[model samples]
Target: METHKSLSPDPNPAAEDDDHPAARRIHRLALHLNPPQGLHSHGDLRMLACAAKGKQLDVSTQELTEYMRGKHRDVQERVYEYFNSRPDLQTPIEISKDEHRELCMRQLLGLVREAGIRPFRYVAEDPFKYFAIAEAVGSVDMSLGIKMGVQYSLWGGSVINLGTKKHRDKYFEGIDNLEYPGCFAMTELHHGSNVQGLQTTATFDPLTDEFVIDTPNDGAIKWWIGNAAVHGKFATVFAKLLLPTHDIKGIADMGVHAFIVPIRDLKTHKTLPGIEINDCGHKVGLNGVDNGALRFRSVRIPRDNLLNRFGDVSRDGKYTSSLPSINKRFAATLGELVGGRVGLGYSSVGVLKIAVTIAIRYSLLRQQFGPPKQPEVSILDYQSHQHKLMPMLASTYAFHFATLHLVEKYSEMKKSHDEQLVGDVHALSAGLKAYVTSFTAKSLSICREACGGHGYAAVNRFGSLRNDHDIFQTFEGDNTVLLQQVAGDLLKQYQQKFQGGTFAVTWNYLRESMNAYLSQPNPVTSRWESEDHLRDPKFQLDAFRYRTSRLLQSAAMRLRKHSKTLGSFGAWNRCLNHLLTLAESHIESVILEKFIEAIKRYILVSALEGGSFAIHKLTEYLSFQVRNIARELVDAFDLPDHVTRAPIGMQSTVEAYSQYTQYAGF
Candidate 1:
């Protein structure tokens, strides 16, 4: 079993200099915040911190990049190099939406032709390579990245996963070569998150041997479909499948199924008859992709167009499925498309790396106020500055490691198709997608503020990165809904503990999580504030496990209790806030465990030192360790300056300031 399903405090012995103004202020703030009290210090902690800053960072940038990029490094680097070589591929500042969209389309084609990105072919041979191509493109232009995903990962994915051999033979190459751009028409105007509630209909017409795809109401119009406004000729339309009952007035609702519906003429590039397309228009970011709304008025496609991997309707309009129920078929179908969530998780971590890379690099070069009469210190030197960027930097590294692990697990699950493995991967991907994207989205803003006015400049790229990434938390599954899914899955695992059910590899950690919960609040363990204790990876892991188990137990009981009065659905709604906390606690534990497992010896010992689950707060002594190795740690992320495109991210301080000044027209 995979060991996933996948820390304390300190003392004040540093002898607060009662007369020192800074120390006095610290005490006052500490009191106001009502901080836990234990006055002690780590003896020789300063010496250890100094040692950590040694002559050179022990880790190699190439080695770290190799680990983070995993097995897809070749494809990643190839795509990266292709874009790096294309001067025009670099997006311009404040271009019109049409121009930006045109450029993105151009880049998408050029990347396919020049970069040799065979997205569908890669998905067949190695999905990681496909994701690598997407991730690499995203690092350069997110709009283009999303455009590629909409075509390859969603529309093509639905065909590949839901359709069988005939579908693959006919459409795979076309989809791969861009001969038939496609959209995943899943989200409706009135139903974004609730797939089961969608009102679009695909009624089987036995007489004509066709399925009449219809938007029953305005609510059923497909909205926010990438590639629908322009370029798309086909779509994987998800709608309720209905079968005629002996030509009577009644039809049987067979739940939702995916059908290949052509929305435009391949030869003319014109909207097909009975299909109306409306451009979604420009918004906060990612205007490069042509997002549009789609409404189908009794559009007809052949019965064979239904992707029949899970269910099929015979010529006579009799529906049959191997799956026992609509819910099971829906779950299996959606499970196959978990690749999107995994890809989003991978791409989100990349965004965080760039955001932190730019922010940290700028922080190291830009100077601000310092001791009187002394040279102004680089903002990176101030404790407050380190607090802003260092922990984010650490968590970036941690999330990167976790995302890498997630990629491996997803690959394993896809190839094996083991029910247990699929469940683990599904829940893990959902949790990480929600957690990591949300983190990266917020981090982008924090990074912008950390850079002050410069980050606001379009040249710095923070604002665009911030805006483009905001939608990540909503798509691939809304963050809140995804977290609830995680929490729901976790609650099942909680119940299984009593059923004597063995946990899956992903949730294997659950087998032992209860031990920590049972023994936690060990008065001594809770108050252990020494540096060594906090730094010990075991204590950190144990503390995280304990917190998660504690929350899981509490949340499960809360739901059970609420159900007594509010009933199941109402009970869930009542306990949602508590459940989300449980889900976050579980995911963070998985990430920290993976981070420690991946690179414990690295200077990021403090990466999660002050994490919420920590039993005891870390001391000021640990800040030096973070400061000493923060540069080396970010370097290990190995993002080149060219990819960042921020004038303030140069290695040389003088060059950084000079470039920023030039960008500012000074």
Candidate 2:
């Protein structure tokens, strides 16, 4: 394979000191590249830090650009050299006729194992791990495919295991060990997100003690399933379970049930008698995964194959569920999707980190304008450049902090079986996933643009990163759809408060609504004298604490008022835009609040570092940089300064002092 040369190391020794201009620039760049260390525990922080180091954490963006242009071919050559030196890994086992399929799967899985990363790490690393892996393999198509497959299996397997112990036992180990590569096939061509409308059926065959699975028509065929085209041996297929005596052919008496259906003959490596498989041809991104369509024609599996945690079947063809209501049962199945959404949100945060790291490093090294009497100036020094980049940097910090909070909430909810908490997590994940991924996509594009012509090249990282992130807007769940789900939940909460509910709840709702209103520019501010209170940082932070409350109330009120004239869909659609607005505002408020809280915590560490102005400024800059670095930094670093402020600050000073003393005479 072809490789590019590496950039020569900077020869100027004075540039390494903290007080030097280059040192200051490097410090700023490092903040973006690595972020704060305390957001997460030290172990995770170390792992991410190690990964960043492996990627040559200090490489200048201009150097990266030059490397991309083959001006410094050795840089690219070194990248490939590092990748190739690693032990070859196995891909997930596949039974395709093509030998390369097996070879590729083995290689892919080997890479994951060699990285010593869990599948969930992909969520934390977002687009970077995938992009890097792709670059290693010399194919973006393969990278995208493998990413989707990894995500699909990891997220899907987690949900399956959590929701049903039986499904977990039957499939979890196989999935994790790469024994039975599978797909979570829920999307049908006719009904993508509308799960209730799926036409595929799993009829109880009491005589044979089997579930007769059938995709009766073209529309019912499962499409867009990762691994289904080649690698997948089985699928956790969702179908409307048909009741024998109800005379309702397409109706689901027990809601949607998952069945572990074997699509290919294990021994023969061929499609089963009644199953049809078709590969989804190349798409915009993520091509390494074999996304395929599957159609079942009277496919049959043993009755035990039904993943019936929420619902079950009797030998006499009777349908039953622990949850009597079909809606609730259906919800039990769909609810697991929240985990996937959460994982995706985390992935978006990772993507943002990589983008920011690239942009910040590029900003520091790339010189643009000449001084009136001299030479070029660093683009990073320009106010406009900082303006374009800083807010995004701030927002990334916001995204990271918010993501950590969400993950904590998710972990808590997972540990407990509280339906209410789960629902809240569901709404939060969906809203945040939509908001963060969309923002990350936009931010990455901005970073790319900020890097100018060089950003377009694959080697500089932006172009490929952008391509890798493109699916974030749609995958896991469509951003708009997720926003609507958040809106729906908000509306439900609002209605409870609208009925003269508890003072605490009502006050919360009122507070949140006011915050939402304030977030938007309004001309009629004089109507409320308390509006001035909104400007207070403390008050703003408090308002943020309850950001979702009022939007839900407003949406509920609007829906209720419009319900008389507009049908449910029409009323929802009419208020949908408003609901989405509320969701976005609510999510943003949470992010802003988290950012402030994180900053406060960091500031405390700074204060304890002693009252020196320079120390304080350094702390402030570092805190903001942590915010800029956001989630990934949180994953890798610990808040050591807060607990050991004196020692930590002393250590930092000693390190700087040592460096200065060493170079004093030079």
- Per-residue lDDT tens digits for candidate 1, residues 320-358, read 999989999999988998999999999998898888888
- What ranges in model 2 sit over 4 Å off? 1-104, 111-159, 162-164, 246-252, 500-536, 542-557, 604-666
Report, for every candidate in turn, its global Cα lDDT versus the true structure. 0.81, 0.58
Task: Give the Å error, residue 609, model 2.
Answer: 19
Q: What is the lDDT of residue 410 in candidate 1?
A: 85
- Model 1 scores a TM of 0.90
Per residue, candidate 2 scores C-alpha lDDT tens digits across 1-666 of 111111112233234443475543444444334433432236445445534643221223343233222232333243334344542432222223344445556555654455333343332223233223332333222343344444443434533542467665666655655566677888898888788888889988778999999998899989888778887788888888876674646444565778878887777778888889998877665545567899998898998888777777878877766686878877766665565666667657656765666566556556788679787876766646765665665566567667766766666665675676767777788888999989988888898888787666554556656765787788677999988887766565555544644322212434345445435423121111221233334555444434455556567778888888997888988988888888897777667666666656644222111111111113233333333333233222121221111111122333533433343353
Total backbone clashes of candidate 1, pairs 3 or more residues apart or in separate chains: 12
TM-score of each: 0.90, 0.70
On lDDT, the leading prediction is 1
Report the Cα lDDT for residue 27, model 2: 43
